[model samples]
Target: MTIPDRPLEIIWDITYACPLRCVHCYSESGRRPSRQLRRDDLLRMADAIVAMRPYGISIAGGEPLLVKELFEVTERMTAAGIQVALFTGGWTLRPEMVGDLARAFFRVSVSLDGATAEVHDRVRGRRGSFDRALRALDMLAGAGPVFGIDCVVVRSNFGQIEQVCTELVPRFPGLGFVSFGAVVPEGLASRTGFAEHELLTEEQMAAMGAPAFRERLRALVPPGVHVTATDNLALQMHPDRIREGQFFPALQIEPDGAVRAMPAYEGTVGNLLTDSPAELWRRSVERWHDPFVVATLTPVRTVREWAEATRRIDYHFASAADRERIDRRPAFAQL
Candidate 1:
């Protein structure tokens, strides 16, 4: 069946509370500042999302499972015919939660940065996190969810991509996709001292771009398993066809209900709690012509350059020194 035309997609960060502290976290999410919208407010935002009729909604978080009434929000979106995708750390995902998630979400993408427990535990900054995540994956597999693994390619785990695709993917029968991307040095990553060493080097990034490496990656995955690379800045350079009811294809809804264009958080179009979805959608479309927005949509040589240019265009997002730091980093530093 063909899908109906709708707005691009929405990445809704339900909360910033997370159990594990990964080095590459873009939002720098943690357990502190346990601030999130009330249940009623979330339902209201869900209603707005339904009204907007986005093609897909990615329910993300510091850890989305930490949010109260998460399944209620998921059910609401699903009931309205919105395709919901859950992006989670899987640290807090328990067996009991698997049934609900399997029924509600169209897909679940869990983070798995390394092949071995030692590598993963160190990357996640928590002991036994790898075991817990593996258990959660087992539960999800048993519960019959269309789940996948998201590996953040970094200096420590870059060599294990083949193992992840060959060994890990086959272990989980429910696994349908494996996504890989280099770490982006933004948010908490920028502040963390270890981010410098964790980021993929210029030589590494160039090697990843080489045709031979790409072919090898494709050859590593088994049949029936899909592999995806998360770096798609070039795809976002062109503005959506406004006349065809397509605006910015994706948006980021913060835990506070503020709606902003994805990958760029300097400007807020509107609040999901206070404004109607139509109004917010209109604002996003209008802002597509804003100088900063236009500049951001323009393509650059590398992802780090794109991010630095994006920050420079928005004075309110970061300071001159921060932009300089970001610019000085290697191209794929903020992948």
Candidate 2:
């Protein structure tokens, strides 16, 4: 495969504030202090993003809707001809907002963990979240945006994905796809106490990314609907992707201004608030070759091990001023 000359996508997590604390949350979202930039910072960051102009940006969040001026930043990026996609928990997505979301996002994805409200709400840690999500889906149905489902296939939701897709397909006839994913051990899921009930086994994680497994799931869905299992574990296997500084194939900007190639790791290449995204990308390319990155990843033979390895690669800002400020962070440590 040809290595990309530039990033194909920028996955920007606009805000770290959310309405739910889902059991498998990678960022421990709602539990952490808010990482959203101020309105001015977001605008300045938007300007930098437009100028840098990677192929597209996926605007993800703890829940993007929580941000008051979210659309203003998205509108600016889209005006500059950058394609945008959105990811939300669907808690605050109003019916009126559906049309605007349709206009701004190339595709909008809403998370749903299970087929029934009982199962979905349990994963979400909110009593009425399942109803709100389904209500949001109903609001989006045939509303002009190409919409889809994002399901994290943990032990509880694993058996329900086929049902999640089949049951909803008729209700929302044009739903794009049901994207299934396994958990990454970080944030709350990383804790030994919490991992037992939800985390997948080593074998389950392997099978989740297997082509034969994906195809088998696809076979169960309707002709118009697509079923996909996310396969990012393969990125850890590709030395070229790591060597090229495209380990994620997307530049990840955490809720704070810190920009990183990989989110599971705390090593930030630069901050969008004070640095050029393009330069940060180049900096990231340079850092991957560091002996520690290779040494740490070499022994990670399974998805669980890789997830653990992710948090172990700690990097700090290059600016001396930044170094002083970054060292105090709870997430950062010397490797």
Candidate 3:
């Protein structure tokens, strides 16, 4: 499928230098060693993305908060009337920092692996990350801007999803949503952690491979609260919602200003600093047919026409359980 003319969201991975070294990090490429994007280069890319007029922009990173000029980025995006969302582990959400974040954007998303401190801290590989994340959440609560939490479901935290919904929803009643990204078989995640039982098994896949899993997930979340599953998980588990009326949704721009159709693609769509939004859109549409990307994006195409027409690409699923559920949906019945 071609890239949407109007983007639902754009993700900016401003830097890759995170404080805590989580085992499942997708940006593991940064952990080895990295340099931050220059201020001028980042500002230029922001201008290009604003020109696209996307509904929202998400600035994330090893931790976006670590970047010195992140405030400028958020200020600029908001000044342009583009809604902005910041994705971070929330380890840095100190009182002073929370005030700063509240002024810069429309929403702030803090990562939480588990509802309790024990599960969260262990997953994040830091002593006090969970406490800090909650502190951040507390700091942001009832501030003008919306607040949300993001987490990656791994074998370690898979069974805790329900608890998270139950505990977090009421604790932070103003929280707008919970965002979940199932483990992607890439970067550091592919390497370490878990036995098969700990992971999503074929049986779980078969049992949960339908909309019921997501619906149940919705039920567990606080009433009226929203939820998002990024990447392939969104493809298999959330396609119906995306199609029903949600939105085209997020994109990712790397430090080099390359706009990926999604954050994980990591290849060049076009340099946001130099190219016009229309040009980048055209280029992404062109590249969508590349055997590689087509296969990656294939799981989202339900109709035979879509599948036959699609060539190559990869997809994201939130968990083995989510993928199993996704595979079982009746989307392909007509196909």
Candidate 4:
């Protein structure tokens, strides 16, 4: 499929610093206060990102809440008529903060790795994380913009997925969505991350890999609740849901005033301040044949591959849903 003309979503890591050091964190989310994006740098990035006219901006972090100035930045984004989404662990949310976020963001997403505190705290390497996350949900429910929860599907929680769905949905009927993300075993979580027992085994993956699992999960999802799995996780569905909105401007300005290609791909891409955002983007476009974007975007075809593989399975989830409710299907599918 051809890349979308404009990015459909842009993720702005408010800070790389996070409160918890989860074993399976992809961004290497940390609590290094020193890495926090500066106010001026954030404003500049925001200005450039808002100029891109993407569908929405996702504000993420080590924990966005760690950055005291996030609300201020969010305020500016809303004033600029930009839609925003916040990604947090929900440890810091308070009653008043929810009201403040409701006016600023389009929606909010919090992470909860397990249905039970024992499992959650162990994975997070912090005590009371699960309780705080639940409380955070209470504070977020109905008090602000729609909010949802993100769970990292692994061997430990795969069994509890149904429980999480059953327990959380009726508990907070106003949630915007629930996403089951496949555990990305990289970075700090690669070697020393979750113990072997915590990781999903091949057998469990096979069970979750079935077309029926996808169908059943969707059926179990509450109406108006979104359940998204990445192309890498469950490929038995539409390509657009997995790949349509995958691209974004591959540039980010760091906290220390250094300009770089995406934050995740920092260092490999030259600095923006030293080089020029426009020049970098142009070079990046010219270097499309280079590994980074091409390599990353190539696998997205998996989404379509999955959809085709499971075409025989009843696509009750896709066919019955309102077209407007779902993301655009892969361009090739329209062909």
Q: Which ten residues in a row have the lowest lDDT in candidate 3?
A: 303-312
Clashes (backbone N, CA, C under 3 Å), per candidate, total: 1, 0, 18, 6
RMSD of 2: 4.7
Candidate 2 lDDT, 91-120, residue by residue in tens: 999877977897788888999988988888
Best by lDDT: 2
lDDT of 1 by residue, 95-211 (tens): 778888988898998889899888888788788888887777878875766888888777798888888877888888757888887665455443334445665667777766566
Error of 2 at 162 (Å): 1.8
Identify the superior model by lDDT, candidate 1 or candidate 4.
Answer: 1
Task: Summarize candidate 4's per-residue lDDT along 161-190 as a digit string, tens digits.
Answer: 877777865578588788776654323332
Q: What is the lDDT of candidate 3?
A: 0.64
**lDDT of model number 2:** 0.73
RMSD of each: 5.4, 4.7, 8.7, 11.9
Ranking by TM-score: 2, 1, 3, 4
TM-score of each: 0.81, 0.86, 0.75, 0.72
